[model samples]
Target: MEFNPGPPLLQSAPRRSFLKFTGLGLAGVALASAGCHIQKETPSGRLDIGEHDLAVLNYAYALEQLEGAFYEKVVAGFYGGASALEKDLLTDIRNDEIAHREWFSDVLVLKKVPRLQFDFSSINFTDRKSVLTTARTFEDLGVSAYNGAGQLLALSPFLNHAGKIVSVEARHAATIRNLLNFGSFADSDVIDANGLDGARTPAQVMALADKYFVTKISVADLPTH
Candidate 1:
């Protein structure tokens, strides 16, 4: 995927709209969704990320782990004898994924969030298209996840950080999409008519992401206000 460093689509929104969309002012929706349940920890070895914020953080951590693992595999085999450009681009992306994973891990530690496990059994590592398609889906989902969670964040610093991360994820999404087809980056499916990309709440995102994750996540106790 060729990375295009274009200006973000939401740069021109009115200040109020921008704040609301960026999750600075609105009350966020709770994290509860179908197919997931929350449980309190009993000090067992089993992992338990209690409540909404932790659940969401764990979600992001899981994605970073998946991306990091995928890139590691790609680099290990140097798929199809990747070109110099491919090697450099993939390497940079791998580093970014690693940073993201570590950042989330650090945050979990600071916030007392639980650890997560991933399952990549569905992805075919040997097929380039399969790998890229999965990458596109993951990157796109990560961007949407941050966008949706922005409004839910109570801390200003975290909200701003989410915005920063979302922008980078958008770039990743666009690059992966373009890898599938030239000029397919930021298609209407991702960017709305208002030029702003769409957002998906934690539940909405997890609905899709859960298939790739073996250990289930629960967000039943997350705050809505």
Candidate 2:
């Protein structure tokens, strides 16, 4: 059955109303003007993500942006064999990603990096296997990115906010995992022997995620610890 993905979300629309609607105003207050640093393209023509907390914020923003775009495309034209449950779940996930993306944008304000362009040409969205695989990858990457970046944040508020967002991302990851393989939500691939989810540094995540982006992101200035 073809799922009506409903009206498309306007990614470019102003975020103030959305913030109010989601009761995220307080969170926005905490993040207001969080990143005031002016970022420039490196000599190699890559966008430098700055240093310290701002760098981590920009990195999360970039990933959220990517996830938002990916989900939009998925809901626009769902893959074959998508069930009613799948459609509903995917739609909810899409909305979640949009909120995550815009929250970072609204809070960062001037400090938010320029929106990066993406290239989803590699995935065949019409194929269920391909779409689910890619979705799983994106969700998994988002969780790991947050887990790894949390330590880099110096501000307690920033860390606290990241914690909240990361928990949502983990839920998305679990849901997608079950969609792909009923009981693989906490499989060995993602879970460590110690029973904790694995984490990846900014550089590691960028290395895996850069292939889908047309705009080259430079994580050189991001903290190693």
Candidate 3:
């Protein structure tokens, strides 16, 4: 997929009300209605994440939740001296992540995992560098998560959905990169010598993502191949 350097596609609704309708405000209700009755954590104090397609989708769902929360917090109170472009881009990305999280919930229904909790005490939202750098990290991790999980998806629709979402994620990563250092949208750190984007297995992703989560996640049931 090609990365577009233009401004993010904007949403028409006011930012204040968007989350109320789509984000964490309704997350618990959505999962409940979807019939995701699983306990939040097992006896070992970890989330199982399920198996096969469900596992992959749950993994994606977990990441989306993390990204959605991060962006929501960032947009709610932008960093000091934040540019108008920064606010707009972050707001757009927040909306996108909320949409992605809800979409996965709607699709997974009975198989969806419980809504997980997060702890962002380590991030300084008021600091510009910290916020954007974290945004860059989450976006890049998201792209790699989808890329690495693609091979494990057993169904076509899930695979197609992942493809569509990852392209948008790649754009987010590119946008953040350019914001940090102009012309570094597809920098070598993410894009390799063969012009291929990076990919990370479920275990590798969780290793990085775990620090921000209050909910312990277990990928033991997730397909390795």
Greater TM-score among 1 and 3 belongs to 3
Q: Give the Cα lDDT of each candidate.
A: 0.65, 0.82, 0.80
lDDT of 3 by residue, 1-225 (tens): 222222243245443343344442254244445533344665678887766677788889999999998988998899899999888888888888987887777666666777878999999999988998999999999999999989998766567667888999998999899899999999898899999999999999999999998988877778878
| TM-score per model over all chains | 0.73, 0.85, 0.83
Pick by lDDT: which candidate is best?
2
**Tens digits of lDDT, candidate 1, 96-160:** 77767765665554343344556778877777787778888888888887777778766564556
Clashes of each: 1, 0, 0
* lDDT for each residue of candidate 2 in 1-225, tens digit (9 for 90 to 100): 111111246334456764454445455554455544445888888888767777788899999999999999999999988999999999999998887787788767666688889999999999998999999999999999999999998776668778888888888889999999998888999999999988999889989999998988788888877
Clashing pairs in 1: 23-151
Better of 1 and 2 by TM-score: 2
Q: Give the poorly placed runs of model 3, Cα more than 4 Å off.
A: 1-37, 40-43
Q: Model 1 TM-score?
A: 0.73
